[model samples]
Target: MDEFERHGIAVVEGRDAAARALRSPELTSDPGLGSPSVLLRDGDGHARVRGVLREIIATLEPFPDAVRADVETVVDALGTSFDLVRDFARPVAGLVTAAVLGVPLDDVFLDHLEATTANLDVFGGTDRQGQASAFRLSVQLSRAPAEPGSGLAALRAAHAAGRLDDDELAINPVVLAHAAYENSLNFLASAGLSLASGVARTSARDLAAEICPARYVLRFGSEGPVAISLTDGLPFGLGRHACPGSGVALAEAEIALRALADVLSGGCRVEDVRWKTHPVFRGLASARVLVSV
Candidate 1:
């Protein structure tokens, strides 16, 4: 609240007002970086890039058998005691992010992706480290060899077909990967905290609504900036800029959480729980869940 007050930004609370603010044509999601990333664009450019992304995401619509198996493998390998953020949620989220981009992401890539949260800061592109991380990821993706059916390949094809410009092609792939990873990473870790603490099992959709990891989304209007609270069952957002990868997020959570539940079914003790301080993305930084064998 002080942040908003300092910036002269309004706080759009409540489900109705937030919804209205999200849907209002008077507001725009772009934070003035002038980047080609879809998240920072509105109007036809956003739609065009978003359409390409939507098509790429469609490949995992039913949550592919391979992805499920990979998630299961990760879950099965979990030791009795592990940091849920590192051992469980991070790997699961990384795998899905890799699948989304059709490129295997390494620890470095995940580290940079995590750091890119600065790129999404509502204050705009003032975070130099965040900008550097995003730039590095863009460079890394540009040189990556993607198979024909991969998301990167699909993006290239779109560019070849003139659907996306050169700048869009270079950056949007990173944007796609970031979008797919960040919230899921946060949500999965937070949800694991709930499960480890003996909360009742809930569907992924319900859990997401409850956790609302991406706590607030910013929009600018003629008046000023407004931070809209998404905790009111608006986790995936509303209106034109709503998360394009929402379906994938839910599917990924369903599979990963189901596997996590099985691992914890024998009971567990959660310890050293910690939370990240970022006002926008809500998540745990560390939580050790010691499972009973």
Candidate 2:
């Protein structure tokens, strides 16, 4: 059995297991947004979904200009490449979470999270004590606020009001970072692949609309499980604990896709596209492309 299954982490496969996981009370009994350890418990239940989304959206805006600009810059850099896993996804995610959580981010913070998240595959075993160090570094770096009057400050306030505990509060940034970055990365990668495959493009506003119609995007690639793996089992994760930020994640991805498509529409084409050898997640670590305006 896979290590995930051996550890009782629930290795869901097949479309049915995927579907059941989405609605499984075990997954949603607690929210996955605030911390990793807490995810072991039941999630906060599904009624909290809308509130979580709203909170994330509201938190992301009104970020310090520097942070927002950093996000755009990183995303723009990622656009030149055909792959989206680490190059595009992690950086974009860091920006999104920093923007949303009012966590001030710089190249340092971005680099740290990118490294930590990327090394997750290496963390489980005794082989890498560095993984543990990186994890601690993420926790520490994620604590700082992006701006004086950002939503994270308010979240802290609310937490002090007894609304959130120390574990939850500490975990908020980590979760936020993971949520915003990873999903954004995946969405961007998928969008890029879609453009590359000619299945979709950036310039066609109408086509973008059709490709990203929430439900449709959620199940868009059932036909090619190997290429895109839209089987509904673990693509977006499962149960209520699945990605609450999916809607916004989709929008971020769509925006990135549109940008890429727009650039390509202007005569740019990706070249030397590459892929990371990751199984749980699929993405291109890097690629060289020609961007002609």
Candidate 3:
């Protein structure tokens, strides 16, 4: 069953319909939460905040060599038996996220980032713990010092330059961090699982299209809230709010997946595979990959 039916949110399915809906000016990402996060708002504020985010994303557009080194090091250290999520995907995503924001993010931080996925979900607005996770991360980033020339620092500079107001400053750092972390975390783990399953080989781009981690995004239309499906070749979305950081994400994937391929070059067996139940983000909960000795 379509989960949106239970929530009373209409769904725009099919490629052409979804694409048209995404391009429709009548629909909006805003849910009247009056939230300051770029993902939840529309109009001028959305553009302003999104512009700042685009600039930050541009810094890592081509991605840095360090990203390749980071994923390589993590994959190289994998033991004969490892949980793909815990040992491989998590660290690769976490490390790249840290680089994206120029902050030190440990397991605890990554855990909270994962939890905050609910906060962004139109279906998950009622999740108290998810909201709490988002709040906690917002506070954490606000107080933590940022590395110069990093995303966090870039956001602060934008705030100082009057590009972002108080509310925008207060929440956007968390928004940016979550946006950077969650998709990568989900996509990498899901993609890693696909490769480990010995499925026919495909490029990271094709894998992403097939496994579109972000299944849907919310938009309020005259008919009320609706979920626009992304399964239709629009993995990164489209129109006004299309993902501004896709290039960086793909670069991250190419490096990480290449390293993963090398790690799995030899024969391997998989067992105890689990999958995340989250409606929006598609990923494995856990999977044990035992490389043949």
The best candidate by lDDT is: 1
TM-score of each: 0.97, 0.66, 0.96
Instruction: Report the Cα lDDT for residue 155, model 3.
Output: 90
TM-score of 2: 0.66
TM-score of candidate 3 on Cα atoms, chains taken together: 0.96
Off by over 4 Å in 1: 122-124
Clashes of 3: 0
Q: Which stretches of candidate 2 lie over 4 Å from their true place?
A: 1-11, 26-38, 43-54, 58-91, 117-149, 202-230
For model 2, residues 60-157, the per-residue Cα lDDT tens digits are 33444565466567656654443445565556665666666665556665555545443234214452543553566546744554355565666566
Compared with the true structure, what per-residue lDDT tens digits does model 3 show for residues 134-244?
889888999989788988989999989999988888888888888888888888888988888888778877888898999998899787888889998889999999989
Q: Better model by lDDT, 2 or 3?
A: 3
lDDT of 1 by residue, 1-293 (tens): 78667768789999999899999999998767686988777889989999999999998898999999999999989989999899998999999999988999989999999998633565754678877898899999999998989999999999999999999998888888888888889999999888889899899999999999988888888877788999999998899988877888999999888989999999999999999987688999999989997
Alpha-carbon error at 173 in model 1, in Å? 1.0
Q: Give the TM-score of candidate 1.
A: 0.97
* RMSD for each of the candidates: 1.2, 7.3, 1.3
Q: List the residue pairs that clash in candidate 1.
A: none
Q: Supply every candidate's count of residue pairs whose N, Cα or C atoms clash at under 3 angstroms.
A: 0, 21, 0
